[model samples]
Target: MTSSPAVTAPAERVRPLELFFDLVFVFTITQVAGVLTAAPTVDGLGRTVALLAIIWWMYGGYAWLTNALDLARPGPRLLLLTGMAAYFVMSLAVPRFFDEGPFGLILGLAYLAVVLVHTAGFIGTSGHRGISRLGPLNIVSALIVVAAGIVPPQARTWVLLGAVALEALSPVIAGIGGFAIGAGHFVERHGLALIILLGESIIAVGTVASELGDVLRVVVGSVLALVVSAGVWWVYFEREERDSERLLDAMPPQRRGRAALLSFGYAYLAMITGVTMAAVGMKKAVTYFTTPLHDFELWLLPLGLALYLAGLAAFHRALAPVWEWTRLVAAVAVLLCVPAGLLAGGWLMLLVAGLVLAGVVVVSRTPGLNET
Candidate 1:
């Protein structure tokens, strides 16, 4: 009997099943935002960072799985659905992950399921032997997550931090020697994930508007938030995304996996976290535009945008010769606006961020100035 093709074909598009998986993935993002919304402090932001880093690591794993496994086969298809269900369960526990309760336990259990299914799916597929190197390390991370639930609430963060540490080490420890990347599917998966994050930012705007009594302020706030989000969208989608894809496609197979690891897996985490922080800030601004902003609210908007631009800079740096100084300069400019934003309140801060990002987009379109 002939064996099924193990890896996705280069010309193959992302399957509908993968999009369905992404829907579940976005739910996790929403839950992480909920955690930040509930507690908009430094502690809250730290928790959001920890939870999101762990969550995003696994989500990236699934994206790699789809890139390397032919989902047209029934076995791989079923495993993908199982992974999706596991993520949905993880999302359910996300909001209360740091709270002292059963939620952390739920998160741990769901996380274990996620890792096991991912490892199994990768191993089950033919010609995916490289997973043998990464799978055990992933399970070790998952077990650490389970242990995080058992620890006291104050100690959970430290335990989870251990997990994050392990995940960061997995690539270095396990190495990226034999993994294969289907360039088209891999790039499209991350791009669609970014779209989901941008959608959440837009959703936050609408959500803030929905809760407010002031129509005029709501309209103004929502429009300003869209402008900032759109400018970020243009910064990624306009040229860098296509250019990165072309570069990855042209790269040697061995190099493509590491490039995907750096650009999509690691850098996208920053972009996702930045969007979540900015969206939380946008909701606060739209809901409370008439009042002076809290310190966290004032800082979140601009700092969030700065982190996002920095992520874009890192994304380009991973693939291209230049560091994309335009984005880095824009990031620094956004950081410098904090004092100005501090004086102007949240609405004005949002406006300034939108304008700054807009300038980046416009400069990117100029011929000689756009090179890096």
Candidate 2:
């Protein structure tokens, strides 16, 4: 690794190589959606969230790493590619993660490699000391993940959740004082990741809809799905992105570290979970557009969107002192559609969510409400 200090220019934009790295995240998101569709139950949801929490923690680490070090250089560039390869291998293991197979062991080894690459990259930056302390915790977490695979299938879920909790708390225990965040690059990196996920949402919808036998139904369902996805895109990009970056840039280093962790790291995890749920919901909506949804399917569409809106509210609250009442209220309003969806169908639920999100976009853009 390069011996350069961890500092990076605050004005730096995301690099092409960073975008390439995000393609792996795209695959990971797809894998997550697949997991949800296969199980579609409370247990499946728990596994999805736990698996994503662990994966996203390390993904955020790479984003922070790129923010601190320029990957245009040969050494950092190569290591990042190595990390990408390991991440891809890890993603490959995601499909059967909770199953009784070698994938659990494979995922553990790949995750360890990813952690090591991330730590090695950080050593070249100003955050080396802090990363040195945080790195072993991540390794131990990876080992815990491996152990989850070894234990009885009935016990794997708890083991994975334990790993998730450890990694989530590790940065707090290790301290973030030494790490430097390039505000612009950090914001842009995550923004791009969100964009990738949003696109995946659409992909999930279109892919599923197209597989259905009816062309007209496919076209209609695809259009409705687009409306919902576009509304989410508008809410996030319209002002949240700018406000987050501006607030982050304006903070002192110490506060910025904590703010980034809470706002981007933790809050975005919720948002991503919401997105994955909504995507699965939309896909199911397409599958059952004419018929009423049963069981967990009925809750997926509305509740998923509700979670996204609520997460956005939390994210705004984390960055600013004020509550985002519009989003919070909208989140609740979306949930009200669950009973109606059971009586009608998922398509109606999707339509109601799209309209609610549209209202939020308009209200958010209103004169006085634009204050961040």
Candidate with best lDDT: 2
What are the lDDT figures for the candidates, one per model?
A: 0.83, 0.85
TM match of model 2 to true structure = 0.96
How far does residue 368 in candidate 1 sit from its true spot (Å)?
2.7
**Per-residue alpha-carbon lDDT of candidate 2 for residues 1-372, written as tens digits (9 for 90 to 100):** 845564655426899998999999779878977889999999888888988898889999998788777666798899999999999999999898777878888887888889889988886576777788888998899889888877876787899999999999998788777778878888899999999999988987888888886775588889988999999899999999998889888898879888888888899998888989988988888888878888897777777788888888888888889887898888888886686677667578778888999999999988777445
TM-score quality measure for candidate 1? 0.95
Q: How far off is residue 32 in model 2, in Å?
A: 1.4
Error of 1 at 25 (Å): 0.6
Worst 10 residues of 2 by lDDT: 2-11
